[model samples]
Structures are given as structure tokens and as C-alpha cells.
Target: MDLTNFLKTGTYLKLKVGLSEENIYSCFKKKDLSKKYYYNKLDKNEGFSYFYGDGALEIMVIDSKIYSLQFDPARYPYILTLFNNIIISHKTSFELIIKYLDIADIKWSFYQRYCHSRELTIKTEENIFIGCVYDKGDYKLSKFQVFEDLYNGFF
Candidate 1:
């Protein structure tokens, strides 16, 4: 199955936040996914990680429920669409993302860059989280992530 099938209009794979691991796995029975344990430093939650398309797609299941989804722009650059089909490429800048969201009237806030080349995060009113990086004096797209809840570390 195309990894883009994981991305939907409202939620990732149409799976609601906090869906059990069993149900999530049932939906991907036809796909070959590899699982491993991952400790997310941002959320500080250790969960079962299932990767697809050779690390292009990843979903973190915490406590046997869907917790987070991460998409690598480098591999599947054209597949990451958001906020009502706003298409974005790997080259999409942080400014462009803000511009798109602002035009859509979607409320969002800058989390931080932390330091050079680090993940600069933005959280939308709809609970969508975007991760970017500072590169060559511009914030380039790093990864797009959807989590079950806001990171505890975020203020």
C-alpha cells in the first residue's frame, strides 16, 4: 500500500487519537512493517515504532495505542499534504508553512528552533505538529509529525 494512504483529510490513516495498537495493526495487515522500541526525547514516551517505506514513514504507538506519526520529507517529498490539501515539498520553507497556515486561518504557534540545525516545531490549533530545521540561514522542512497530545515539554 502507498504510505500516503496513512495521510488523510482529518487524521493520520483516519485513526483517531488514542486508538489501540491492535486496531491500528489490523488496518495494516497487508503491509509489511517493522517494529522496534523507540524512546521519543520530545514526548519522553517509549513506544513501539513501526516503520514503512524504508524509514520514510513511521508511527509510534505508546502504551499499545497510536501516539505519533512522522513523515520524512526526503523520501516521500510529494506525499506530505496538510490543511485541506495544501501540497508541500521537501524544499518548502518554514516561512511558507506559516504563510499557508495563516492564509487558511489556522491558528498555530512557534515552539522553538533550540539551536542551529535543530528541529523547529510548530503546533496547530487542530493538534497538528510540524518539525523543521535551520539550514543555510533558512528553516527547511525536516519532518511532519502528528502526536496524540502536545509534548509535555512544550509550554
Candidate 2:
């Protein structure tokens, strides 16, 4: 599915990354797709929401450039059935994830500092860390986050 590109570009169907907001809006509008924008107190923080199926891509845009990307597989119907696509889910062990990423030598934490819940983080792509959050300490994957700007509290 070229998920790596999707992760990088923050758009499905192979859209160009680092494009202007005007360009993106024009492109999707021409294709008859709906998009939403959100802005908060921080001008450094702006987001665009593009909904497909039950899931949506909440892409962070700064200075009209795509900065970070995340996928909501929880709302996608085919996610669980596609077990082989474990890259986006927490269907495997944390140890195995670290082993697969070849970063086992680095310490693995049972809990994330932000949430105080057990979490596992492993590199999925260049500078991209996929974190699986286990809220109840069941050691099972409850949700996932695509972390590009780790400083933004996404870890």
C-alpha cells in the first residue's frame, strides 16, 4: 500500500507533500472530496482533517507545509482482518517489535512518561516512531500513534 509514502505525505492516493494549503485545497476540491481545517491558540499548531471511510488523516500543517502525519486505523473496517499489516497496529509483542526494528539494545520502557500507562515505541520509518499505548496494562495494543515531532507530546 506504499504506507511509507502515505506516512510521509499525509495523504492517500499519492499526493505531493510540502505543498501550499491553497494547492491542496484546490486539488481535493476538484476531486470532490471534503476537508476540514482547525486552528487553536498556537499559530504553530494547525491541522487539516481528511476523512476516508471511518478513519481520517489528522495532518499537522505549519507555515502551509505538512509537518506531521497520523493514521486512524481504529475506524478502518479492514484493519483487524488484515493481520499481515501489523505495521499500523499493536498485534505483536513489544520485544518482537524492538527485535524487528533492530533496536533491542536500546532500553524498552513499559510505561510512557506522559500518560503513566504502559507503552511500546519502535521505529517504523526514518525518524518516525510508532507507539502502541496499553492503557490498562493488559500488555495488548489499544491504540497507535505516528510520532514525527516527538517534542509535540505525541510520544
Candidate 3:
């Protein structure tokens, strides 16, 4: 995946395991606070400025069943960490997109580059979680693909 372009246009969808909408919103607000603190550190190191400006994040309910909280790349990690520390604090599953495409019934391949490169087929109706660590002027979100039929595998 093109990490640069991906981060630029990608939006994150975070699933709150067992929290109410109001609780999730409150926690997210606190997470944004921490993001501002960490983001300043990131900025000093020449990383992307991570901040929750107006409309940077939003909450939506789809189909009267699914509730999601969306955020930009800058605030994504912070929100995840907030859920981890204050809420679950153990295991969390969130999805990331390299880029948004219009086609819904399509398949794509995700690739990673290191000393060698590797690729894998990304199946449709699957959400992915990535573990990322920032270092040496770059961030790496490890590849994890979860099939829609195997939702329990991630939770």
C-alpha cells in the first residue's frame, strides 16, 4: 500500500466493544487531549501534525445497528490508546485503510517493503487491524486481516 497517500486520505473506524455512545464520546474527547500532547512531540520530531480540529472526528450510526467513531490518521492512534488504557486497556480491534476506493465488490493486494517485499490478497468484507510503532522518521502499521465471518477471531 502507498503509506503516504494512504495516511493522507484514510479515515479510521473504531468499534467500541461494550461502551455506550455517550461513554464512547466522552472517552474520545479525553483521548484527543492526550493526542495533542503526543502530537506536539511528534511535530518536534518532524512527524505529521496530529490534532483534532473541528470535524476531524465524528460519530455515526449505520443501519440502526452499527455504531462507529471515525477519525483521521493523526488522531487514530491516540483514540486507540485511549480505548486501551481507559476502557479495554488490554485488546482492541480497529480498522485502517490505505486508501478509500469506490468499488465495494473488489479485491486488492497489500504489500510491505523492507529488506525484501511481501504481498497478500485483501479479501472483501474483511476488516484489518494494524499494530504500529513509529521510529527512524517512519511509522509501520503491521498487517492484520480479519474476515467478516470470523469476527470472533479479532474480538
The TM-scores of all predictions, comma-separated, are: 0.70, 0.52, 0.24
Among residues 3 or more apart in sequence or in different chains, the pairs in candidate 1 whose N, CA or C atoms overlap within 3 Å are none
Measured by TM-score, the strongest candidate is: 1
- Residue-by-residue lDDT tens digits, candidate 1, 1-155: 22233332225555656778776666566366765646775664666688866776677888888787777776652365655466676688789878777776767787653334466788666656677877677677877676766454433
Report the Cα RMSD per candidate: 5.2, 6.1, 14.4
How displaced is residue 2 in candidate 3, in Å? 22
Candidate 3 residue runs with Cα over 4 Å from true position: 1-15, 28-52, 62-66, 74-150
Arranged by TM-score with the best first, the candidates are 1, 2, 3
Clashes of each: 0, 0, 1
Residue range 1-155, candidate 3, lDDT tens digits: 12222122232333342234345344456565224222245444322122243433444322222243333334323332321232211122222332332223223333232123222223222333333344454444333322123343312
Score residue 51 of candidate 3 by CA lDDT.
Answer: 29
Error of 2 at 30 (Å): 6.7
lDDT ranking, best first: 1, 2, 3
lDDT agreement of model 1 with the native:
0.65
Worst 10 residues of 3 by lDDT: 1-10
Q: Please provide, for model 2 over 120-140, each residue's C-alpha lDDT reduced to its tens digit, 9 standing for 90 to 100.
A: 554433434446667555455
